[model samples]
Target: MGVAAPAASATPTDVAPDAVAAPPGDNLALTPPMGFNNWNSTHCRPEFNEEMVRGIADLFVESGLKDAGYEYVNLDDCWALPERDENGKLVPDPERFPSGLDALGDYIHSKGLKFGIYTSAGTKTCNPAGFPGALGHEVSDAQQFADWGVDYLKYDNCNNQGVDAVERYTAMRDALAATGRDIVYSICEWGQNQPWTWAQDVGHLWRTTGDITDTWDSVMSIFKRNVELAEYAGPGHWNDPDMLEVGNGGMTDTEYRSHFSLWAMMAAPLLIGSDLRVASEETFDILGNTEVIAVDQDPLGRQGTVVSSENGAWVLSKEMADGSRAVALFNESDTAQHVGTTAEAVGLPAADAYEMRDLWEHESYQTAGTISATVPAHGIEVFRVSPDGDWAQYPSAVEVGASAVQSEAGTTAELTTAVTNLGRTPAKSVSVDVAGPEGWTIEAGSATTSPALATDAALTTDWTVEIPPGTPGGSYDLTVTADYRSPRHQPRQDSLTVEAQVLVPPGEGTSYVSDLAFVREANGQGPVERDTNVGSVAAGDGTPITIEGTVFDKGLGTHAPSTVEIYTAGRCDVFSAQVGIDDAAGAGGGPPQRGSVTFEVWADGTRVAATGVLNGTAPAQPLTADVSGASFVELVVTDGGNGKNSDHADWADATVSCTA
Candidate 1:
């Protein structure tokens, strides 16, 4: 039978009529709150203890997060006991928090950080353990929270018992005011009641979507929902799209960078939702980008609006307090795309030239009017554009990009680099130079120099690079440098680096793909495994490849949203594999029977084979693809419609047939 929907709530007229009259005048969250929340990475796990909480505060101070404007260190559910005390007051779990909540709050405050706590507006919290919530006991619970020195309150919606959202949320707002403490109020109703329409006068921030999962599809879905509500967000009030999942193990660093950039562009709350205790250096770099954070915390408090979206390319622009515009060129497709927009298009006034600063690269270039970039698949390029007249001092904005080349060992490949002038001024004596590794031949094609290049014009230069014989099958980097003179006759130079892959086909017969080295790989959870099932939680910690009780001696194991590119050198004719969710995914003590993924094979950037979404219970399915004359074959797996929880996928008996 189908599940029932939430019943309509009965309006409570007598509850906090003054609460809905106007928003709290405390001026909290003038910008979206920036901090960390311990729910996405830990859930209700045993590691969510007092010691871990204190460690997070320490990391915030030592890791420069505190200096970067991250203030609150909050706790989610499972911190309270199953029931209230004799006086009907919520109590902290003694075993988990022996020193109690007030002491912990003091420790966080000692570090110059604020303390935030969570409780539901319903009778019970969201977890299956069913902790006490603040339904009719709002007055006492708010007072207890105030006495505990809480600076922020994340009031959730679970077991709401058919009470109106406005009434339940308003009751807490009034009760919090009664405590006379300046507590920031966050409403977590999951947008079921369209909170943005009326939440401006009720709370500091309101969630506009359900919980976010750590996956690419989940990020895109939430962005699509929240990006449309720009009008409702401003100073002291924000439309939340749930916590961030940047450092979680469900997406690549590129995808995580896009996630962070998009959230900053949307001006959403920057509450981190990862375990900072074990976060990697790359994670810290992404979260510590001050330029991006400055855009989110801009006092002007204008949410970015979409200027255009077509063919998986999106352009969003936000006006800053200093009369600058933050433009984001986002690519949602599966391949690299060139996305561009004009300064006038992003609401900037007409000017002779503008300074476009690449937020990710931390470089500034002068552009006549265009703001553009060759965005990678599922990536973003953010630029802060402002009117300027320093064209003579700076070189013309030149964009350089190159196409990947596929060639076998001892073979010659052609690589083309396109240099475009994006500024209002002209470039003179433009010349291109190509460089490669030692013992490798690099020669430029005909017409490597131009006397003069006009604005908005492009100069394409091709170079033939030879791969040394016996070179291993992998990716190699080639650097291209473009030299020119600015309008003021000053010497200028811009350089770009690109990758080229050398394909190593198998011998005259069919061979197992596990024996070959991949040219590129990206996994969701951990590193891709060869001849074994995906690891339990770390690299090289997996068992033999097994799917539905069938063991494969020669195959590969990996997580969803993974891609493993094997070099075929256009000599391979066919590729075959038996693909399915690894049986270990369901057997582990982790969330059982929750594994779901899709398997696909792509030859030379074109999909050749696919299997619809498969769960843990499905048997192994045979897949074959005709990869004739294809230089590379990519084995890809994506999470099912649901979030990525236990998506351990296997490619059993994976083999490729090639000719000598």
Candidate 2:
């Protein structure tokens, strides 16, 4: 099979030849289509049948995703039959899809959701076991999809070697329009030929990078890469950074939230590629974050950009429609970090008191100078800052901080107040006033403090408040007022509020397995890596496998042999890890331009799995073998594949399956 491999284009301009007919009527994706696609979770597996799609559609309705504006449920590669019918029209795989595509589409539409299908622009589809190709029959296939009630089309570029991308994609765009159906066209040419500059006329969104494997490197790389192309994305068309890998596992909740936040800021389509039927409540909530979703679907349609970034802490700011700004403080580093930037840096009107709403925590903060936070590792803090509309006539420096400590109901809860001056002027006498809810035992703290506050300095105090046992387990807000006077001026008054939540006692749960059973080989690249945190791991392995993304502590400087080793004291059946050339280290264009790595895996000095050459463009594979009787496993990656040419390999999500 001669697959038409494509390359990504970084050039700024597109070579648009001619324009095609506009899509029928406007119900199609005006903004990047918010939907779910099945590819990241289902790799054309046999178990992915129509019932699963219907069940996912049901979940879309039940989980409030449909109401939140996620409209399409798409199936990627392998849903098609091996060949077209006598009429040369694409057909669904009868064995896997007993109800056929028409019935499936009807079922999806019956639930108020749209249905989408996938095809390739080349001679043959990418599916190793699916339909032949849709190139020559673009017209017939488009008509056939419309006939079957298709609402969206994912046009891939597999097997389209030697063919011009603009010619191919534009032809399909015209064919879809000729069919008299309003289908949202999606171009998946792996960003070859700079689709961003040209895809506006052909598709609603176009993939701007290679297929996203679930990994922190992969996700963060795409995030950083796509945000730079903000000017290219717009209202009708968007820069598709591939589908989302959320809930597919291989990542902590923090990384996934960062992923979602980054994608939202970039104006990328929010396409869930996970099993919605089995999604956890946490996953459901992340996908249905209406505030974050609003940023992605903003009517202004302006993609976000990194306004400020340093030392793995990045701030992406997006301009919203209502003159507000969406800001995300992302900590890409493995350790927690304190990141901050001026409100003006994130596009807020200068020196004005703005109301900043924490989208994730659903809280509000009023600040005049800067937006700042101490973010967790692999976590993000997103906020929407809008002018309080009561624009400060005279800018002041002092800020009264109000915060609450959450505790179980019937227990003592803590309230905290701090005074901070972000402005130049400081107050000589600083005092705080506190108020509690009705009928609650409010043991307040000292109302005033003696310490004079200076610029950028802070003073804090705490109060112990007893929450009544009969009070409901929910959040309570305490009103706080601050009275302070500048040594050179008169007393001024401003008020702020702090919120605390009372929780219910948790129930006793069954014993669970702890991560203490896993041990590192002392040279693991970073920390314990979730399978999805490293690029080479399976898309949805769900099992966290340790990975080595770097060959050296400071990064790839010298080309040396890299290895990942792990051992199990108990009985283990299998050992596995996804292997590929790491993009993070190799993208730097260091020595050895072409990455070539050959890995030989051993168990107790016995060679069990020997892989061929691995590189970046090549699809990463899971290197696994039976080590049922072995006590130790060793994976040696050598540069001998192409004689030490940037052989930075990622033994992503390495782990062993214990028989115990």
Superposition TM-score, candidate 1 onto the true structure: 0.84
Model 1 lowest lDDT segment of ten = 1-10
The residue pairs found clashing in candidate 1 are none
lDDT of 1 by residue, 566-643 (tens): 988778999999999887888334345669999999999999999998888888999999999998899999888786
Candidate 2, superposed: residue stretches over 4 Å from native = 1-27, 390-456, 460-660
lDDT of each: 0.86, 0.70
lDDT of 1 at 367: 89
How high is the lDDT of residue 229 in model 2? 81
Candidate 2 is scored at a TM of 0.66
Total backbone clashes of candidate 2, pairs 3 or more residues apart or in separate chains: 4
Clash counts for all predictions: 0, 4
* Per-residue lDDT value at 569 in model 2: 38
